[model samples]
Structures are given as structure tokens and as C-alpha cells.
Target: MDQVVSEKVARDPTADYIAAIEEHGYVRIPQVFDKSTVDTMLDRVSAWFDKTVQAQSARMPRLNKQQPMVYNLQSKDIAFCRLILQTPVIEDILKHFLNDQWFSSVPAEDPNYILRSFLARSSNYQMPMHIDSFIPYTGSYPFIMQCSIPLEDQTRENGCTVIVPGSHKSNKYAEQSAIEQAIPIESKAGDLIIWDSRIWHAALDNVSGRTRWSIIATFCRWWIKQAFDIPGNMPQKIYDQLSNKEKAVLGFCSVPYDDETRGIDMKRSYDLLPEKVADYRI
Candidate 1:
């Protein structure tokens, strides 16, 4: 049965990913890209980092050589945009999580998911155990999810992410006991690991002496405030090149408030509503 299932997933990655995430609150999908693709991305990241350092050095004469990270890669490079927006498996999983209209105010536009943040972490960077849903919201559905793509091999020695399975179902924050039960997710280059934002997770210390390269792309419901102003900050040329769906995902269509003056307007119907409008009223 296991062999049969593995073979099935090799043919259809989306179905397997959905099942695995539903069961474990996270899933590791292997070989999403070939080695050559991974190598190209890594090279781009390295070049970006070098440019950033040169630019920053003029302002601060002595910058500490700590773990360096580049944020908002969608705006910085087209490769990241393709990886985050063009990947079919990623799009399918995001649709499953964000396309539901039950929790959205404007059902027509609310189901869209937007990129929250995209960053590449390198060197000895160890993150503290915590859940990504730090903001308070009145919804049972997951508000955010994150996809981690390693540009290099992630091993126990190089600080792979450690996670507590099924922790997303727990309504409470992670306690010391939950942290102790965390297990490392060792993966190879080009592998993609995704998890519910509410899951308790952390990265281990890198003792391998080699820089661990990984890209983290976080997505959230369209209504949630993005980490960066993607639509506003993105290069005009790149923004112009995006499709309608990509524009929606980058929050180009999400309005802050609907025009109540427009009579009999279904588009702005939910805009004039109060907080927790989805809740049943007495």
C-alpha cells in the first residue's frame, strides 16, 4: 500500500501534499525542482547578498558579519516571483487554504491569498520556537501558511527546521513541553516544506560550518495586512508583467474600504459592515 501510494504521489504531487498536510499539519514534498534550477536560484541569492552588502557598507562602516537575510525577493528578482507564483503545486495548495469564501467578508475577492513575506536566510541563523499567527483574528480557518524551499541540503548539522506535529490544532501557544517534542525536518536541495502558520516550529543551530541557504515564502488571506507593500513596492516593469491572478495574489484588488454611497452595489456590500460580521447575531 505504501509503495503504491508513493508511486501515485510521484505522478500527482498535489493530492499527496494535501493529504500529508491535513494529517500532519505539515508536509515535505521532495524534488520539486532539479539540481540545476536550485543552483541558479542560489547563485542569484548570492549575487543579491553581495550587492546588498556593498550598498549597506557605505552607511555603516562596520556591519557585523552575522547571519544575512534578504527580504521581499519578489520585488528583487523575477526568479523568486516565478517560484512563488508560477509553481503549480504551490498554487493548488494555496487555493485549498485560501479560496474558501466562508470566512471572507467580500467573498468575491476575499478568497485570494497574498504573499506576506519572501526572504532567504543564510549562515548560522537559529530561530526561536513560535507560531506565525501572532496577530489576533476571529476565524477558525488558518490565516497564514509558509513554504520553505532549501537552496542547499538541509541536515541535522546545518540547522533544519524542527516542528511539532498537529500543533496547529492546539488553540494555545507553544509551551516548553511542546518545544521538547519538536523533530528536525532534514531535506535536500529543491525540496519544499509547507506548514500551517499556527504550528509551533523553530530552526536548529548550524554546527556544520557551511552556510545553510533556504527561502521562506509566507502567504496569508487577502484581508490580512501584508508584511510588505508588494503591489506598491514591486518594480513597475515586473508589476506590469503580472497576470490578473498574480495581481490579486499580490493584493492589487484588495480594497481597504468599500464605497457605501454606491446604492445596490454587491461589490461593496461587505465594506460598510462592523467587526465580526460573519458571526451570528441575536
Candidate 2:
């Protein structure tokens, strides 16, 4: 069997990643998490999916049974929130691409990268080639990016993601001809694959008998509408537990002013810093 070799310890790949994405529209960082951490996450996700499926069946008489997938994972678990907000390498890469002034500026700009969507998928499923930015209501500029973290090895048999290199620069979706050239990005457990939202990508069929688990998270500029109302849907306790920076990234700072009511309540809702307030004013 072909195996993807990975580092035993985590290291920063920001410089290499920036270059790779600029040139190829995607890059993979190996062993961002240890095997134990990946195993724990996989177990938690499996348990959650089982519970969710049971609850869904109880609520409805007819059930459409299918491979388990849990969306809005950040709201579902604090562990997911920690993974998204506190992962150092992920943060570095996102800041580099989304906030250009990060290196030169002291107390770098927030970038206001909101977690637009997050989900965990397991089982035999294949996604057709598509550009996420082309979805309705998605806006351009300071582009949206997606990060995939696999809890199990991604292989040809387990539906690893296939992507076209340099497709983001094309400024157009892949035609049938271009998609024929897409290549699968085989990776090991704990590997992270980050790609531009404009890149043409798809998932291969999973012929592997066991479930193939992976988490997909998308982040975008604050101005873009999120796939979910993250803050509002979150439990009040979870919302209160997040740090100010985490809250800002999750879009607590992106609230628009009440032009109709001219209300200050929106401002009062969050403890926004001077810089954030200034950015909001613009």
C-alpha cells in the first residue's frame, strides 16, 4: 500500500504554503496533529453522528438513511471551536493570505475571516468538480478558502479530494475537458489540505469498505454571507465562553449598523476594540 510520510512533530509551513497556493491554488501540510488526537476526534465525531441520526429518526416517521455528516460542527462542539480558532499553522496561513499587512503591522489586522461553514463527512460519497465561490450569494475579493483535516488516511480508495492546479488564476470554472486532468491529493491522517475557494475540485468515489472521516471548514471575508448564522445558532453558554478574538473571527464583530432603527444596541452587544470599530466604520 502507498503511504504518505509525515512529520512526527508539527512545524510551521506558512512560507512554503503561501508560495504553493499562489502557484498551484492549494497545499497540504502533513502531521498537523498527532495520531492520538486524530483518533479522539474521529471517535467523538462518530458518536455525535450516531446520536444525531437517532434523534432525526425519532423526530420523523420516514427517514432517508445515508452516510453520516454533521454540519456546523463549531456550534456542536467546543473541541471544534478550539481546533479552528487555536490551530497555529492554520491561523498563520489564513492571516498571511487574508491580511496582507500582518507582517509589517504591530498587532496585525483582524482579517475578519469568518467561519462560513464546517462539516464532517464519513462513508462512500463523491462530490463533483465545482468552485465554491460560484455558489449563489458568494462574493469575490479577499477570497474564501477551505481547509480539510482528515482523521483517517485519504487514499484513492477512500475518496481523497481531486483538484486542478493553478485553476484559481483561470478566473473561470473548469470545463469538462479541464476536469479530466484533475489529480487526487492523497494524504495521511492528521494532514491538512488548504485550497482557494475558486479552485476547481471534487471528491473521488470511496470504495474503501470502512468509513472515511474528514472535516471540511470554510472561511471567508467578513463581508461575505456565511452558510450558517453561526453566532445566533450557537448556545448562549458556548457564545459566552469564547474569547474576544475568537468571537471576532466567528463574526461577532461583523454586525451591520441598524440604519432603519438607528440603534446603538448592535454596538453594545460586542466588546469591540478601537481598531475593530474603526474597520467597521469604513
Candidate 3:
């Protein structure tokens, strides 16, 4: 993947991303992460899935054994996820949406952003139409955005994400015509899809026999609620292991609704923090 991105970067491939999002509310950045890194994550994820299946089996009787399933990203191989969250490319993308404010994975009072992984191991899972905005947010407070990166190539044959172009500003989802206007986004591994959360989107059916895997990290303004409660689920020990910059991104300093000025100041929200803290004893 690195070679792919390095070549794309040399040719300035990101130029289209900004322009596409500005015009159509979405854009695709090909080969965002290096291939080796992506392959490592895939292997790690598979191992994690197998481990979970074994653990679950131990808790149930042999007669009750069921087909193996891959859980969402938040629960499996957390360490690998942490590495992905802190990648520089992802952070650069976040800066466009979040500005200089502290961003975290933990949900605030009105959660604005969430970083989640989705794996379609079964053929039946389908996400419904919904916007990233807080449904109750009546006016223009949303300005929400979502980023989807595929761990595997996203082909129409394998259920790529389908969206309605420019639907983020419309009220058409209630109409039958809206369903007919959807467009599928197809790409290869390491491709990044950034879109307006307000756009009507649904996961396409995976008619192919293989599983589909993707990771999405959503970024929104500080005023909205996240889909998941980040801080509540993250253990204290895990939180302690993170650098202050990561903690800020995970919403540890304050709930999402707290005053913006009260949040931790992250010098590197998209990159790894310095190896040593000012008060470090190590």
C-alpha cells in the first residue's frame, strides 16, 4: 500500500478529494494506508476473530456451538485500531472537519463523532438510511462528516457503500424516488471515502460469497452526540496507556458538551504524540 500511496502522493492525488467533497459532498482518496500495514491489520483482525470465537465456544456447550462471526472494530484487536486512529493521513482529513478543537472517540452529551469498524461477515447485515446529524438538531448545527476506509477492495460485487449524491441537503429519503437515486462507491484496499453524514447511505448487499470489511471514523462538530459512548466503554488502564493527545481524541478530559476551551490541547491529533510527556517519570 505504501508504494501505491507514495506514487499517488508524488502525483498529488489528494487534489480531487477536496474538490469532490466541496462539490458533491463526498470524495475518494485511493490507497491512504500502506499495503503492508493494511495486510498486517487484516491478519491481526482474523486472529482476533478466531480468538473471540474460541472464547465464546468455551462459555457455551458443544451442542450450542454456532457458526463463527466477526465482531465490530471497537471490540476486536483494539490495539490495531488505536494505531489506525492515530495515522497521519486520517488526522489530516480530520483537521478539515474538526479544526483545532480536541476530538475524542468517547461520546459526549450530544456525541458529535465516533470511530467504528464494520465487518460484514454474514450475508444478511444491512444498515438503514440515516444521517450523522443528531436527529433532533433542527437547524444547521450539524456540518457532520463520515470517513470510510476499506480493509479489502470495495467492489460492487462485494457490497460497496451506496449513497445518494448531494442528498445531504434534501428531504427526499421519505419519498420512494430517493431509493432509486443511490450510487455505489467502489474502490480497492487502502481507498478512503469521505462523505457528508447528511447524505442518505446504505450498505449494498454482498451478493458475492466473501465477507466485506471496512472501517469508518466519523468526525463532527463538538456540539453533537456520537453514535457510541467512547469513554464509558474504554477502561481506565487503557486510557492511562494512551498519550495525552490520544486521550483528548477519545473524549477523556470532558464530556462532549463541555465548554470547548476546557478540552485538552492536542499537538498531534492525527499523529503519534511525543514519546515523553513533560511530567513523565520513565
Candidate 4:
């Protein structure tokens, strides 16, 4: 299982993850899932990756060979859609850090933070140290946060992630000099690693010659434009399988309408979300 090597591990149910993120920029929760579930997810994600890479090979030849990341996963399979629901802790953490002034026709307990992006990839190359918060801003609070879940063991040998602690508050990108401060975060399958989007992080090269796949789902303030147009392209097969909360996170309730004929409000509540996939597209 993934263990926090330097940081004092959170072993109690009431562990202060919010505080951890506030002070250290990230927190790692070891073995949040069981072996069986990890095995199943690894199987599904691997199969999907293989099929998708093959189809997109000609169009994205360089990325296929270099990165091989899959995009718009919510529309591809029920398994990907369900990943968010399986982690209540992630939602709770997001609510505290990201949800505020989430306007609209407000609903009683729907998520205030919507998913900005969701994708899975196997790292084969070294990613330069950088921050996910593209634009620099002054603040300890982050507008975006990322949840990364590994489907298998991650070590320095297989391109484990590395991070510079407490870097989010800098409100700046990593300088080449910061590389000396980066520390490896070795983890096992099913560990949940959440970090402020501004944190400096990168992946090592996979010298092990084996696939090291992980799911990275980015959550942000409701107002931020999701990296993918999920609601516009969410397949009927996937939409039909989602709950009201899931649909909202997938942006079904927040998509802008083409005309006033549909509606003017961009942010909406659970009650406003259409139950049918046919009415999902605005």
C-alpha cells in the first residue's frame, strides 16, 4: 500500500486532510480501495486505453507513442463515470476547499465543485516539474485541486510521482533550481493522492519497461470551464447510467444553452437536471 514516507500518515478516520493540503499542498491516503477493485479497474482502464490508442494512432501518432493519455473518459464507459462516486472523501475535501458562492438555482446537497477534467494515462517519459495551476495568483487557497489514483504500484523505478511540499503558496511555477527539493511519492494500487492544483509535481521515466497507469480527475470551482465538453458529448449509454449528482458533476446541469428557448441560467441544481439523456444536451 502507498505510505506517506516523510509526512506523518493520516491513520484515523478524522484525519485532517484539509489542513494537510493547506500546509503541505497535498495528502496521500493509502489503500483507500481493496485489491479486487483495483484489479478490476486496472483491467477496464488498460483495455480501454489499448482500444482507444489504436483508434487514435494515426491522428495523434506522437502523443500515442510519447504520452498515450485518454480524454473525455466520462462518455466512454460506465466504469469511468462511477469512479467519482466511489470516493466520498474526495468529494468532501473538494466541498471544503472549492465550493463557495456556487450560484444558480441552488439545490439542497449537490456538489458545488464540478469536475474540470478526467483522464487516464501511462507515463513512459519524464514530465518536467511544473504546476497545474497555469496562471499564477496570490493566495493559499487553490481554485483547482487534483485527485490522482493509481491502479498499480508506483515507485521511482516505474515513474512514480514527485512533489515539492508547500509550493502552492508561492503562486509561481517551479524554477529549475526547485528540482533539488522534489521528493518521490511511491504508492501502491488504490491509494488516493489529492493535491492543490498549484503544487509543483512531475513524473519520473518508466525505466521498468512496463505500463504504469493512473487516473487523474481534476475538480474546480463551478465557474471554471471544464477542459472537456462532457455534457455536449456525453454518450447516451453513459448518461443513462448516471445519477443526478453524477450528471451535474459531468456538467449536464451547467452547460450554456444555444438560445433563450432552452434557458439562460448556466449554473443549475439537481432539480433542474433532466432525468432523460435525450434532454441532456442543451
Candidate 5:
């Protein structure tokens, strides 16, 4: 167990974040990136929102019924998203969460798919309670993390994330409680909230009239189905242009014929093409 964890840290120096996740099931790393980057994303978000309003004539409906006050944006716009995907802090955190082998690309633009980007308005907008993991299927070693990056100051009155501490070990999901213990995550724009999926959490009321915008990127083991639609919704041009490595992460590669028989005898070569036989006169 020690060696397994040591190997993970070697891949990236930011292993304490992972240790925190293992021990506490969550970690709020402060100042993972400079304030400028966070501010830039906020600016980009504001500009995009303005453009959206003009294009739709202020008629764009709420993305999800539960999130009327929030708008999901920046799933596309590669120029603005490259920073999120390539941020060293994000990579360090992923190194721990994915156990060193996971790789995922940004989803292309599609109306059917969306990543969670919430802009909370009024201290009264409350998010319904939920756990991120699927109870029935998430067996012993369920590795998943919900990463929240605040774009502005998050206060208790600003709809800060509310999480139930040490709930990851629970086998059954708990019901909403009037007496539920909720930990409010307060941070500046550049801070990160990486929480275990098993922990029950919700977006609580933002009493402040100002909007509290947040960008959330949730990641899990490669085997788990992605939260957002991938190839089905990804642009064809984008899919066709990817390399073998990208395709494998995108779930385009074939699995071995059997579970145990896989890789040992068959040795699924992700880089190798199918064996082709040419027609010949015998």
C-alpha cells in the first residue's frame, strides 16, 4: 500500500492532496494557481454570457430544471478552456485521483451535453441534496472526485459548497436532514475543492444578491461511464482528428475478448491495428 501511494507521488509532487482525499475524503487546496488565471476565466465567462444574451435575445432557458439560477458554459471555446485542461494544479490532482494512468479530453460543443458551471444568484437559491456515485454499482474501491473552482469570493451567504464530512465510508446514502452537518467551503477565485463523490453535498442558499460563479470538473476512474456525453455528442471532425491515445481514453478502442484472458495471452495492443490478410491466389 505504501509503495502504491509512493509511486503516485513520484508522478506528481502534489501527493498530499491525494493523501488528504484518502484520509478525509476531501481536500480544499488554496491558491493552486495564480489569481490572474482565475480572473481571466471570470472575464471570459462574463463575455460569453453577454454574447449569449445578445444571440438568444435573452431567451435562453435554464440549462437544468434544478439549476435555474446557474448557467453551464465553457464546455467548448477551446481558447478559454486550454488553461483549465492544462493547468499544472489540475494535472497534479488528477495524477492522484486517476492513479497515474487516466487521460481525458474536453468535450466538444453539443446542445445535448454540458459540464456543471453554476452562477448562483441571490442567497436564497439552494441546490437539492445528492451524492455523485451510483450506489448499486460502486463497489469496494470507488475512486471519484468532484472538483469545484470558484470564480469569485465564496462566502456562507454566497451559496458556498456544503459537504457532509467523512460520509464517503457510508454504504448507504443518507436522507436530507434538517439537522445535517454541512461544511461550507469558503475560498478565493483560484482555490480548488476536491471532494469524494460519496460525500453528500449541495449548493446552499446564496443570500448575497451578487452571483457566485463556479466551474466544476468531476473525474473518476477510466472504467466508469463519463458524466458528459463523449463520442456521441463530440464533433465528428474532432473525433476523426484524434490519435490512438486520445481514442482509447475516449472509449473508441475495443476491449479484450474476456476479462481474465485479456492482456495476458491476447495482449490488447491499443497502438496496433487489426490483423489484415490480403487476398491471394493459392
Candidate 6:
């Protein structure tokens, strides 16, 4: 067996954050990226958000247009892809909570989780209390998880996130009556806050006189259905810029086959990844 974890903490570097999540259902890691780096990201995001919202407004509703959202950021820029993938210690924490037992798959070495969604959102008003996992279920492992990074300061006045402590284990949907119990989890720009998707949470109303922006992404086990066809929609230029591991996390290693003759294994090892998007997008 592994070392007696309850008695002595594991020597692994991700242990402290893991303990926080096990006890609180969420954790905020401060300064994952320095301000300079964050500033550059924010600049790009600001420009992208404007262009995206303008193009999308032609068909979207008036209310949705006010909030401004850019979906599938991985398809937009390499930097957005790196936001979730290249963060230090994050992958370890996610693996330990979501799917570290890579040997469960046929190849026995490929990762067992994939990025489900990547989007940029801004808050102009409050959101209702709810969970992101879609449906509730009891299990040792969560069906999904989320990470949010603010482009600017996140505080009560600017409409920071609020979550009920330890509520991820509630195994029930969030109740509007319980908003009084939820607490604001404030953090600075570039800081990351990750939570189990089952947690009861809401975004508070923004009254600080400006729109607030946050980059959010959801992750799930490899076999779960993605919000959209990430692998199928990956742009050729963006695909070329990603590393082997990055492509794997984006679902290149587990795309569904069109038919038997196309391929058999969805959980393929990294080496088996196609040299081009055409190889699998059929």
C-alpha cells in the first residue's frame, strides 16, 4: 500500500492543495502567473472578446450580448490553451482528484481526463446559485471540475465568485434559499481558483462600476462527452502550435471513431496521435 496518508502527509508537491480540496471542495492558488504575464493575456483577451461579441451579436439574444462571452478559447489562441495546461502544480492536483490511475485505460499510460470546455466570461449582473456538473451523482470521483482566472481583481464589489464550503459532497442541487451561507472567494488577477463541479456556487452582482472578466474552463474524465467537438474543431494553425501533451488533453487521443474500419481504440497512447487533423476529423 501507499504510505499511511492519514498519519503523515505525502511528499508529493501537490499534497497541500489536494488536502484543501478534500476538506473544502475548492482551493485558490495565488499568483500562478506574474502580473506582467497576466497583463499580456488580458490585453489579448480584451481584443478577442470585443471581436467575438461583435460577430456573435448578429444572432444572440440581447441579455447574452450584455454579458459578453467567448466560447472555445482553445480554438482561438494558443495562450488560452496554455492557461489551463501550462499552469504549475495544477495538472497534478487535477490528476489526483479526477483521474490519476492512468493504467485503467487499455494503453495503460495515456491520461484519463480531457478538457471539456474553455470560455471567457464577464459579469454585468449576478447569476443564480447552481452547480456546473449538469446532473448530480454520488461517487468517489467527480464528473467534472472548473478553473477560473480573473483578468482583473475579483472582489465583492467587482462580483467575485461565492461558493458554499464543503458543498461539493452535498450530492444535491444548489438551493436559492442557501445563498446566505455562500461566501465570496476573492482573488487577484492571474490567480486561479479551482473547484469540484458539484460545489454549490454563484457569481455575485457587479456594482464596482465596470464589467468584470474571467477565463473559465471545465475538465472531465476522458470518456465523458465534451461540450463541443474539441478535436474535430481544432484549427490547423492552432493544432500545429500545441505540444503532444497539450493535444492529448484537448481530446486528440480519445476522439470517437466514425466506424470500425476507421480505428478501434479511443483511449490511445500519445505516440498514436495523428500527424494531421485530417487523420481523425473524418
Worst 10 residues of 6 by lDDT: 1-10
lDDT of 5 by residue, 102-197 (tens): 222322210111122223222346775668876613333545666777778888887877766666766667458821676777777877777777
Query: Model 5: runs farther than 4 Å from truth?
Result: 1-13, 50-63, 66-75, 99-124, 136-140, 235-282
Q: Which stretches of candidate 1 lie above 4 Å from their native place?
A: 1-12, 54-65, 102-111, 135-140, 255-282
Better of 3 and 6 by TM-score: 6
User: Which digits, one per residue and each the tens of the lDDT, describe model 2 over residues 1-282?
Assistant: 111223343254477676777778888887888898889889988888877765544332121136567777887788888877889878877887665342231135444567888888874777777788764232233468898899999888988888888777776765656657888898888888888888888777788888888988998766678877775677666666677767767766665554645434333224442233234422
Q: How many clashes does the backbone of model 1 have?
A: 0
Off by over 4 Å in 4: 1-15, 57-65
User: Model 3 segments beyond 4 Å from truth?
Assistant: 1-16, 51-78, 100-128, 134-143, 171-176, 256-282
Query: How high is the CA lDDT of each candidate model?
Result: 0.72, 0.71, 0.54, 0.77, 0.53, 0.78
Model 6 residue runs over 4 Å out of place are 1-13, 57-65, 100-110
Model 2, position 108, has a per-residue lDDT of 52
Error of 3 at 218 (Å): 2.7
What are the per-residue Cα lDDT tens digits for candidate 6 across 1-282?
111122134466368677777777788877777888788878888888878776763666444556868888999888888778887566877777667575344333434678999988878788878888888666668869998888888889988888898888888999997789988888888777888898888888889998677889898988889988999889989899888777878988778888887777777766777778878634
Give all candidate RMSDs, comma-separated: 7.7, 6.0, 8.2, 2.9, 9.5, 4.7
The candidate scoring highest on lDDT is: 6
- How well does each candidate superpose onto the true structure, as a TM-score? 0.80, 0.80, 0.66, 0.90, 0.65, 0.89
Clashes of each: 0, 0, 19, 0, 3, 0
How many backbone clashes can be found in candidate 6?
0
**TM-score for candidate 6, residues paired by index:** 0.89
| RMSD in Å for model 3 | 8.2
Better of 3 and 4 by lDDT: 4
